[model samples]
Target: MNWIILIIAGLFETGFATCLGKAQETEGRESLYWWFGFGSCLFVSMFLMYKSISGENAIPIGTAYAVWTGIGAVGGVLAGIFIFSEPATFWRIFFVITLIASVVGLKAVSS
Candidate 1:
C-alpha cells in the first residue's frame, strides 16, 4: 500500500509538471488555472510522499525517493512527447525506458 501511494505521488508529480508546461504556453485565466492545477498536484504529491515514508510499512527514504523521482521523470518525458508534442527522438525514448527499468528494479529489490 505504501508502494502504491508512492506511485500515485509520482503520477501527481507528473501532473504538476504537465500543468507547469501548459501554464507556460498560455495566458490570462487559462494560465492561472494551470498554475492552480500545478499547485494542487504538487501538494498532493508531497503529502503522499510523506505518507509513504512515515509509517510502520514505510519505505526506506533512499529507495522510495529514487523510485518516486524515477517514476516522475519517466512520466514527464512521456507526457512531453504525447501531450506537449516534444521530440520522440531515439535517445530520449531509450533513456526513458532505462529509467522505467531502474524504477522497477528498485521496487523489486525493496522489502
Candidate 2:
C-alpha cells in the first residue's frame, strides 16, 4: 500500500511539472489555476515520496523514484503533444519508448 502510494505520488510529480509547463504559456487568472495545481501536486508528491523513503531503504526507494520519474517524463511529453499539441514526431516517440524500456529494465534489475 505504501509503495502504491509512492508510485501514485511520483506520477503526480510529473503531472505538476507538466502543469507548470502549460501555465507558462498562459496569462492572468487562467495561469493561476495551473500554478496552484502545480504547487499542490508538488507538495503531495514530496510528502508521499518522504513516506516511501521512511518505509523503505534508500536503494529500493531510489530505484522506484527513478522509474517513476522516467514514467512521468514520458507521460508529460505525451500529454504535451496531445493536450497542448506541442509536437509528435517519430523520433520523439522512439525516445519515449526507449526511456520507458530503460526504466522497466532498471526496475527489473533492482527488484
lDDT for 18 in candidate 2 is: 82
Candidate 2 overall Cα lDDT vs. reference? 0.80
For candidate 2, write residues 6-39 as lDDT tens digits. 6687688888988899799999999999999999
Lowest-scoring 10 consecutive residues by lDDT in candidate 2?
52-61
Model 1 stretches astray by more than 4 angstroms: none
lDDT per model vs. reference: 0.95, 0.80
lDDT of 1 by residue, 1-111 (tens): 999999999999999999999999999999999999999999999999999999899999999999999988998999999999999999999999999999999999999
Find the candidate with the highest TM-score and give its number. 1
Structure candidate 1, residue pairs in collision: none
